[model samples]
Target chain A: MIDHLPYGVFRTPGREPRCAARFGDHLIDLYAAESAGAVEAGGTLRARSLNDLMSAGPDVWSSVRRQLLNRPPLDHLVPLSEVELLLPFEVADYVDFYSSEHHAGNVGQIFRPGQPPLLPNWKQLPIGYHGRAGTVVVSGTPVVRPGGLLGAGVVGPSQRLDIEAEIGFVVGIDSTLGRPVPIEEFHRAVFGVVVVNDWSARDIQAFEYQPLGPFLGKSFATSVSAWVTPLEALASAWTPAPPQDPPVVPHLNDDPHHGLDLRLTVTWNGVEVSHPPFASMYWTPAQQLAHMTSNGATLRTGDLFASGTVSGPQRGEVGSFLELTWGGTEPVELGAESRTFLLDGDTVVISATAPGADGGTIRLGEVSGTVLPAVI
Target chain B: MIDHLPYGVFRTPGREPRCAARFGDHLIDLYAAESAGAVEAGGTLRARSLNDLMSAGPDVWSSVRRQLLNRPPLDHLVPLSEVELLLPFEVADYVDFYSSEHHAGNVGQIFRPGQPPLLPNWKQLPIGYHGRAGTVVVSGTPVVRPGGLLGAGVVGPSQRLDIEAEIGFVVGIDSTLGRPVPIEEFHRAVFGVVVVNDWSARDIQAFEYQPLGPFLGKSFATSVSAWVTPLEALASAWTPAPPQDPPVVPHLNDDPHHGLDLRLTVTWNGVEVSHPPFASMYWTPAQQLAHMTSNGATLRTGDLFASGTVSGPQRGEVGSFLELTWGGTEPVELGAESRTFLLDGDTVVISATAPGADGGTIRLGEVSGTVLPAVI
Candidate 1:
């Protein structure tokens, strides 16, 4: 797919409202196609903004997908340079999960030598936490550093600050309270994917984490990629996962054949890193979804979930700064760059793709950002 | 403590402004106490709504505690039966943690075999998620289940549900961003504690857990205790923690002098079932706090923390019904109440007390509420 396609609310600088997806140097004006009867299956795509298209559900997403796949190219698509990618959807809610076995195990080794890396329940479930979606900003939006009130007992109060690069997923439609969508069918609930940068502070978390978990240390700004890649386009690349060790409790385990094969990698300043396969995880996304929903809560579209620190065991494959730097004990060398943790002006880029054995590849495009100086 | 002090604001039949806390049988009227020099160290207690007192910080809370703890002979005390316990503060942030080791391990065992109960990162850092504080209501306030568009298929729908009883701690002071407050000294940022009822819908969580942790399922509305307990009262009961299995990394470990042993119990319809002690947690409150600040985020007062499921290995000690009933397969039988999970009209009460090896326990009182049926 050489087309530079991006989902966004498109309107020419001097024209009426329209929803369009860009295709390499060109725009596939969805509204124009719908009006011209070229996109008949999903008549609902004729809306002014993508909200209607997004809310119309996955069937709409699929029908639109089919039309895009078959119809001859339309001339209405403006040049990629002529249009702006108005973020396709508003973030309803955001939640993050710590699923990186490399991260979990390494940290585990530090505290308890030779012990199993993850908690038993982790394999059975998708361990996750809720996040602030209102603060979820599109990539390119500048974020101001957040400040905190500190006790000035001895040392002059200010402490350490940091940043993290992680992948986030978006939900398309949600389920209601009384019914649960089964695990085998969870992929239908997925809307697309985004890149997330969850910034943090080492100081505040230490003090407040005693009885509860993180509060102020994370409530600040979080950045996410604007485009969401639909689950359908990526469906053909499904792959089986590695056998789970010790086995997942029966109810929580996914069918052996089930799971996605999204190849992901991060580039620091331009140094390419591992695009480890999702199959490498000790746990699968299906297991995580089933376990998360066992309690019967509803999921909504435009919601974001992060695979917190998706690091693998290899030192270079670690997903986040905490795992990459080993709590800042070792400095990381990214090609021409060498640093302990995320430093000012550092830029991190992450992207995911399904690299087919036959060389056909479909991917969740790159999410990149540059860190600015910490706000005083 | 015998005073049936219910917190609320009221006036005799048709009188002017009035605010009071349930104390034994007498309502310690703030209006009355302020005029009597009971609420002040200098001259007199200032008569105002509970809102005013909370915003004033430690000084006001100190003076009030002094008067309440003075114990002026039970015979001379007034009964709280005639007064109301008004809500005293507003919550700015609601943060919940899954800190119960029993809960962590039990669930872990189900998913992972022979693995350590908690993850390595969990010990070195605090795991938490933030929630909207606007939905937080004081105890006795009925919580309304939220409504949303949900489904697995783009347009399909569901109504699965669940519930959780938890403990909430209230922050008293505020911390700014980029500053770290050591866990040992985090208490100064705390104002007091409260009980919490965090309702969940299992169905919704399943479909949407991957890209985000929690959204509509946890965000709808969360109930919390209204009375803010001062940290000073719980100070005497704060004790060291039970040792961790694998020692934590040096940077994360504390001197072993300070983890509080808060014995907690929860019941559905007044029968005790979930009985996990805070002592069983792998990470202490101090450690959780310190982890959050490691990134330089600030801590603040009035911020609330919810302990994620506090389940232990024992049958009756499982924190949530999802754990106790094994995702609702094993029906949990209370004294005469059989609850596979929480049902509409079922009331869950969570009570916590600090056990002193040498003195009486400091308590966080209780968070109680009945599960109302989902709005059709």
Candidate 2:
């Protein structure tokens, strides 16, 4: 926990939300620390959201981190259980990228039978799309099963509710409009990482995603972890990315060792279902960032881009139930029960950890959600 | 202009940005009026953007309008040329909907030959997707031509730069996370409308849009009019939307007369090229709202959803150059020049008008932008 000082927004009873940093079993009140002259962030620590702190740039970020690491403010420490966690940052623009070759191939095989497993542009670029940012909630937020058109004239609650276990990168700095961010500037442009669970309604998505992309099927809810692990904390987690067969554009070229070696675990009803390897991702976060801004889309503070669904080659390593169950043909066992799609009250938890600089495990915050019955 | 007192944000040479209202050739300082006790909007009028005022709900909105109408604040009126207009609202989540049947059909014929123009679920629901909210700028902002991958390993400035003349609805009040906004609550959910120019890179879009949707092709920039015409101002503009071939789901069914009878004119380099009839749109704004939130997706205060492109039946009524020129095969005359796609110096202006309640023409603010060379 000392090495992984993730930031979050928390509020005590009857108090306004403020920024904090997680310690062993307590939280450091950043605003109080700043007020006491124990740290400096130019009044950004007093903000209700992390946007201002993030926008203060890397110099301020490192200075505050060093100060907190050197001189611990023991008086401002509050018990974790005494405060309520809120969404860490205000999301500017949310993008979900299908960067995992295994996940994309499985979805392609299931969605379009007899067609190629991968699209023509899959290897050439990192494919992604914008998502609803307002619905990005913190962990523990109950996800009500969304109601949508399952088929033509058939309106009902989603029968194929599913979850996508992925990792998201948070942008902390603003980029010039119409200027592409190069791959080498990933660390300067991005602040931290968060575990994400992009809830999906497969039935509705299949019926509507054609000329356009997914809308209601995905717009309903997207849950993210409250804690944001700074990129500097993952210094020892750098691993080589998977090789690309067809060479990419020159603008997307970069050192291949930019991938983070985080291991993600997905648990269904407290039963560990899968362990997804982040090292197996074909597209690195740097490449994704470069490709995202290749067309000169401006990056704003609090912009979030997820590494789609993390999946490996094996059946047990898949990130989504649609692939795990082979599109509902098979059911995975959950405790004593076997199920296909999510049932009401079904809970899913996704947690991850990376190699620490001190040769220990550094935990990225966990994101968990429970499916509530639809408000039909 | 009295009936259409649209709200905007403006700043003098050295003053801070504040809220204002558009008059004939002058701007009414809303903050000054509120301070003088001539108008009431709480303190939202003093804010830098229109989000607070819009979030104050319909009651406050109508009350302020009544006070401003009943008594004109003659002293605070500033000439329009003396101030610089800013983006009216801070966009929350932007959703672009394909509501024009003619635009969809033309795109289908050009992109997917031999297939049916309309997809299977086209008539059953309004197709929409989330777009980049941060890139949405105010009118008169220069658009730099974006560079993207045209083919495998081929990267260059976009050759098929095009414009989509659209009308966007701005959400005022927010809805609950798990609760859907019904069709009847459209008036309560929406505040006003703005003219939009959704810039596009057709060549990049054709290559990249596969399983997901348009990403870099359309995320570069989306320009909107500075002034926001309140829904109350379009009292007599209500017209019947085009009949749906297959009846929609009950959730999407709404008043057929909810469509606005707007007349949009498109100018390219000062040449009037098209007159798109907004009344002929297949799906109304009410239907778009109902479908967008049917899945329990929450709406935020600054959420913007636009009518994709307001193309009608005739060739001269199309909204995009891709459709009007048949995918760059037929060029359109612009003054003494001809073009299939936008040139570096080409300027596009999209303005619209609706029938006023007092039997006169009410002008919706115009959105105009000029194309600048790509920053290579």
Candidate 3:
């Protein structure tokens, strides 16, 4: 069993947003727990969000985790189903990285056709771009279908809607303006991980994403899990990342066993579709962080960066609908339902689990979102 | 002379950041002004930033402007040179729109070689993407040179540092989630405009920008002018946007005279190099805003969206170094200093002026940034 106390924001009806610690199906109200002397922290756990807690740094994080673990079960422990979960932290900046070589190759082959599978600079850098932070909603929030101009010269609701199953890292500490965080110090910067469902409009993306990149096509809504799995909880999940073929820069180089061996599963309407392995990723979290700050771009508290479309080499390991259905040419069969691309009311659930120290499964929570009809 | 009060954040020596408004050579301290009954607003005028005031909406904005104009000059008025200006508001989201047809054509010709000047979807939608808001600094902030992996296998400081002269719109009111803000309602959403210097790294951009977009290349430091010219202040500057060849969709089509006729100038190392005209932009701000929210992305207060490289048809009207230098083949002559890209200690200044009522020039302020030596 996963012995982790992932932090999240929850609230009962008529009550304001409150911070809580999740353990199984119960939520320990940190505000009430702190008031009862169960956990002593200088920061405001009473705040509606986790931004203040995240900005408290690693020492405070460790202390809070220890305090929560040591405390006895309090009366404040409420069943998870009773409370509504909100976005854990206010997003400052959201960046999505194409970290998996398998995913990149598949996308390149399907989209470009005659072009090289991977770009010439793909092996050297963890390629990433800033994503719309305003559109980042918590898991369980219904995603409305985005309407925009598409490749076929048609302008209306998206025809080829898709979802990318990925893992997200949350930044805790704010970095200095011009300082670049070294790859070895990534753990100090990033506090926790969460599952993310990067919603996309493939047809709109193909048309608009030429020289600049993805815009409204992928900016409609990006769903992230409410429960943030602390970095301390994933100690046993660490594994060796895929070896770099052309080798990366010194700044991006990390230890061999730097990747997380999480098994990410993508389900469409409760039916399992893809199983993208996190260990098969070409670039590690450290490399992504290092690359992000390498440009003198400061990292703010509540900043999030996700591994884009974590796909493996196997046929069932594709992370996105674009990859699994081969750009909507191949249809996926799910019992009575068939799908090439996400239709109206399509629900996508991405769950993840990692290896625990006791050789048991460690649940990293899940992020799921249902699609609403387009407002065309 | 033009009578306008542009808001900004400034500091004097060891003091905290204070809200101020510029008129001629003086910056009126809004905090002190409110205290002295010069301006009355329900919100905190004593705020170190203008975000609170901005979120107050157009009514508060108009009141503040009227009060400042009606009152006589007080002791709170400090010379602009005495106080150091800072970023006016906390940017929630930063979007850069490729609204200039001339700049787009130049870039397409240089980058794609034989391809058409404009892409198929270029005229259909106002192309834009989310940019790194964390790196957005105020005008005077010194930009540290960025270092990242390049295509030539060299991993160090960027070799081709450049700047893009553009106009930026600052959103004040928060729009509802999953709702589209109409083209006609753009003014109600966007409060003011600013001069923007989009600092870029050509080498890094060329290598990394692909299916994702500009990341490290453009995320280093995007500078904005300290003073923000309110939409109400630029009434006379309104002119017709260039007629769309194929015509736009219903949602994008607005009044013919929707574009602001702002004459923008870019100076490199104290020498004027470009004179990009905002009137020559293909898409209007209304269209950009409408297209942005058409995908259901909510607009938050302090959200900034900039016109990407406001270039005209003239030779000297190119906004970016990539165009002015013709991809470094035709170096721009700056008197004794001829250059293709920015060098160490190079200062870039972008200033603009718009036609005011009563046949006067309305100063739109300026955004300037100096490049520091690379930390390789």
Q: In DockQ terms, which candidate is top?
A: 2
* Prediction RMSDs, each to the true structure: 12.2, 0.9, 1.7
Write down the C-alpha DockQ for each prediction: 0.09, 0.89, 0.73
Clash pairs for candidate 3? none
lDDT of 1 by residue, B1-376 (tens): 5222323344454555455655544555556665554545332223333445554577766755666566422332345454344445545456666766666666566545698755554543446767645456555554444333343222122244555666566655655544445666656555565667777655554444432345546655576665555566566666666676555544356776365566678877878877766656656656666644543444544456766665555777666777777767787678876767566667777777774325555556576766655543
lDDT of 3 by residue, B88-115 (tens): 9999999999999999999999988998
TM-score between candidate 3 and the true structure: 0.97
Rate residue A355 of model 1 by lDDT. 50
Worst 10 residues of 1 chain B by lDDT: B149-158
Off by over 4 Å in 1: A2-6, A9-18, A35-51, A110-116, A145-165, A202-207, A334-337, A356-358, B1-128, B131-345, B348-369, B372-376
Q: Rank the models by lDDT, top first.
A: 2, 3, 1
Tens-place lDDT per residue, model 1, A110-216, is: 54567775554454455676654444555655544444433211121224455555667666776654344467766677766666667665555444333234455
Question: Model 3, range A1-376, lDDT digits (tens) per residue?
Answer: 2368899999899999999889788988988877777777774587889988899999889888877777644667899989999999999999999999999999999978998999877887888988999999999999999888875346888899999999999999899887788888788899999999999998888888877899888888999999999999898999988778776778877875379999999999889999999999999999899989988889999999999889999869989989999988889898887779988888899999998778887888799999999887
Q: Which candidate comes out best when scored by TM-score?
A: 2
Better of 1 and 2 by DockQ: 2
The order of the candidates by DockQ, greatest first, is 2, 3, 1
TM-scores for all predictions: 0.56, 0.99, 0.97
